[model samples]
Target: MVQKYQSPVRVYKFPFEMVMAAYEKRFPTCPLIPVFLGSEVLSESASADGSTHVIERSCKLSVDAPRLLKKIAGVECVFFIQKNTLSWRDRTLLIEAHNETFASRVTVLETCSYSVHPDNESWTCFEQCASLDIKSFFGFENTVEKIAMKQYTANIKRGKEVIEYYLSELMSEGITEIPRWVPPAERSSPSKAASPPAAPSSEMPAAALAHQSPRLQMVSWGPDKLDADYIERYLGRLTPMQESCLIQLRGWLQETHKVKIPKDEHILRFLRARDFHIEKAKEMLCQSLTWRKQFQVDYILETWKPPSGLEEYYAGGWHHHDREGRPLYVLRLGQMDTKGLVKALGEEALLRQVLSINEEGQKRCEENTKIFGRPITSWTCLVDLEGLNMRHLWRPGVKALLRIIEVVEANYPETLGRLLIVRAPRVFPVLWTLVSPFINENTRQKFLVYSGNNYQGSGGLIDYIDKEIIPDFLGGDCLCQVPEGGQVPKSYYLTEELENLDHIRLWAETIYQSAQVSKGAPHEIMIEIVESSSVITWDFDILKGDMVFNIFHSKRTPQAVKREVSSSVPAVNNEQLIDRSWVLGVDYSIVESPLTCREGESIQGSHITRWPGIYILQWRACGPTHARVDEVLSSLQGSAPKCKVMYYTEVLASHDFRGSMTSLESCHSRFSQISVTTTSSSQSQDGSLISR
Candidate 1:
């Protein structure tokens, strides 16, 4: 496996010319870097106008490896070829380097660039990326890769320090700036002549300038680049390699899942959860993203309203901040009647309540981060287990609790900063045994349990939470608004109401709808447009087999088909809107070109209606149309090829089209708009499968 690294943009509050001069001083030899032995120029060239310079050098470096490994490799030092291309006209420098020793066995490539900051003319920005590939290393490939990556990351900060040292040296010598390069003809012009340099007495101290905090340059990096200062200020500090993994994973998402990309803080959480393993983090994050989309989790705070019974009986609610500024949630688990609540509102209602709490907790965290002026990505939960007992561990309730734990662990990794359990009963151990295995190891370490009166004194709640804000029930003065849960009345039990509730239907109350597209019997919907030029927008994810999508406009409406329904099973609308006897062009004309969608791909697009009538959106399975009757019959008898799609569509008036366009563009849809002209046949648009 090849290892890669990317460094966030580092800004120097100095002109590009001065930064370039300091960078050049690092050549020949730099005592600050012990491993950098020396470098000799192989070739040098400059343009006639002195606006462009190119240099190639052979650098020698001592490898910091174990003695046994060095002896086995029969090498003490390695060589690398460094090439620099300086464009004074563009105010940029590009550096490329590659290892020379063991080129066939192991490959190391690095690229670095220094350019003028986009927003600040006086500032210079630096960025770097490198990759290491070890094909064969005498049965020590893994060890070599680990050692090489460790050394590389350890030197990342050192490289910046070296540049700062050179910069300080130059400043101490009264060289505060370097004149920009110019053509001979322009240099002679009085208007084009450079101004006199600033005096040394007017400049700040070199040491102070070198040690100052680096400012974040306000550059338009779009959504791809992550600023170092932003990361530190918003997502907390991360190692160089951790930052690289975050950037790489985010870049992959931007490339594949363009719509609804999670925030940087959210992405960082996944990276931390996986210990910065790119592939593992990517897999975990992709699964969570899909879950969020399928269940409409992103809008839970807005869409989910807990039942009145749950609001009054649920034992959990947000309180105040902990000592570390984390949002604190007080859950009176011991006092709450778990069995009564589950029996009253059903397990699905309880699960939805929990999800809403999590969503609200995350929002509170963001708000607290701004209020506290620090990064608060997780929250603290204080469980008042004074009333916990065997009744709380009822079989059905335990099963429901386990399911909730599994969902939260998989989707909300690393969100719990601390879990404080106070006044635990003797039976708490039994409950813990049933659920602790489902919790993540990282999260489990944050659990703090205190039984009996052990939580009152030092090294207890006071150490993590403020004394005054402790709930009144916990012997503190502050009053908590969390619902005082009790045994629900028998009249509230939803026995008959929940007996036939489908698990899938619990989360199916979303704006999106699912359809099954099979061979010949295509799934489609009809949209009635009363005004021309109105916008018809559609977003859908192909969840199964490959299928083709097309839009057709008809002057006449198709009759709705009424089918027999089974009371036990919910209906799946897979009806074909277009009749089989109707001809393609006569009955309905294709308004947009056909788009071939593959499994796991999400497609969003819009079309402006040229005429008012009916629009049919269709998804048909893709396969050979000439299969033999017997072969098709045999396949159908066994398992027919089918496609599943989750889709949502909306129509906007002509006046509303302009207002919604911004949102449509921001979604990064593959097909932003479709031309109204009809095509002879459908063609597949460029699309990528959702990353797993």
Candidate 2:
């Protein structure tokens, strides 16, 4: 496997010319970076006008590796060829380097650039990216890759420090600026004729000089890139590698999801939750994004208004801040009647109430971060269980709680800094036992439990909460305003029929629809397009086995098929719109090339319609193209392969297509002509049509 690393933009509060001068200081030898022994210039050149310079050097570095592995490799030092291209006219420097030792077995390539910051002309921005590919290393490929990457990351971290050191040295020597290069014709004096302009003192004031530090100001390079100072200030301290993963993931989302991408703080939470594993975090984040869009969770804060009954009986509300500035929430679970809420409002309303709390918690976190002047990404929750009993263990109520927990765990990972449980009764463990399995292990670690009066002791809630702000119900002097829930009246209980109807209504509120695809059974939907040149856009996620997605168009409408509603999985829509008797070219024609989607992959693409007709989007289970008839029959008798897809489709008229289809335009756009040759041979094979 090849390893790639990308560094966030590190800004230096100096002009590009001054930054270039400091960077040149690291070429010969720098004690700051001990591994950087020295470099010898191989070639040098300059343009006639002295506005462009190019240099190639051979650099020597000591390899910090295990002695045993070093002996096996028989090398004490590694050599790299560095090529520098400086364009004074454009105010940019591009550095490219590659390893010369064991080039055939192990390949390492690095690229670095320094340019003026987009928003600030006086500031310089530095960015780097590198890749390490080790094919064969004498049976020590893994060890070699690990050592090389470790050393590389260590060097990356030191790069800013080294530049800052040189910048300080120049400042101490009273050289605060370097004159920019000029054309030969424009220079009048002999002193200004040098190819690389000499450093000159601007006699800058002490206060002005103090502002030159990179940490003094936060630079905004817009959404395309993250500034190192901005990351530290808003997202907390992250190692160089973690920053790389965040930058890479954020860039991928920006490229794939052009609009409605989550905030940087939100993306970083997912990265931290996955331990900086880029691929795993990307998958988790994508799923959450899909869920948020499906339910419009992003707008829940503004759209959700708690019912008056829930307002008085929910037993959960935001309190003051914790010691570390995290927003504190108090949930009087013991006093609240869970069964009453479930009976009165149904599971869906209860879920909506819980979700609104989470949304409110996140909003408060952002507000407190500004108030506290720190990175406050998560909140604290204090649960008081003084009035606990066996009535709270009702099965339907517990079931509703579990569903809420699942939704929060999947969508709100790493958003709970601490969970303080006080006055825990014996039945608390029973409740925990029923729901603990559904909670994530990372979240479970944040639980801090105290039984009975232990919460008022020295090593209890006081350690995390301020004495002045602790709720009075928890034995503190402060008065608690959270609702003291009681048993709801039986008159408020919802009738069984009304409760079932409300549950289904709330469950079907999502915009995305899911379907199951089995062998010889393809799930498809049809869109009637009356105007030519309109755009058909679709976004879908493969939740299970592999499947092929294709777009087809036909002038005649296919017979409508009734949706087979499964009792076990009511959310799944098992309906096929393409008729089995229809021929491929005779009845319908494939518009776009078939795309095979794998499990856990999110696909968004659009096709511009050439002619007006009914367009069918089909998702068929993927299988062998040339299986024998007996094999197919045997497979049907056994467990057939199944695939699940969650999808949403939209049609934009020609006038609105360009403005609305930005996110899907970059996706697969291989538009094939509606000709017989474009049809796939596999479409005519057995098991290709929807099974009756």
Of the candidates shown, which would achieve the greatest TM-score relative to the real structure? 2
Residue pairs in candidate 1 whose N, alpha carbon or C atoms collide under 3 angstroms: none
The CA lDDT of each predicted structure is 0.74, 0.74
List, residue by residue over 397-507, the lDDT tens digit for candidate 2: 899889999998888889999999999999988999999999989999999999979888689999999999888777688888888888888888899898888778776
Candidate 1 overall lDDT versus native:
0.74
lDDT of 1 by residue, 558-626 (tens): 874423345653445666566655777798887766787766566766766667789988888885422
Q: Give the C-alpha miss distance for residue 101 in model 2, angstroms.
A: 1.5
What pairs collide in candidate 2? none
Q: What TM-score should be assigned to candidate 2?
A: 0.83
Off by over 4 Å in 2: 189-195, 198-223, 500-502, 517-522, 529-551, 560-586, 589-613, 619-643, 650-692
How many steric clashes between backbone atoms does each model show? 0, 0
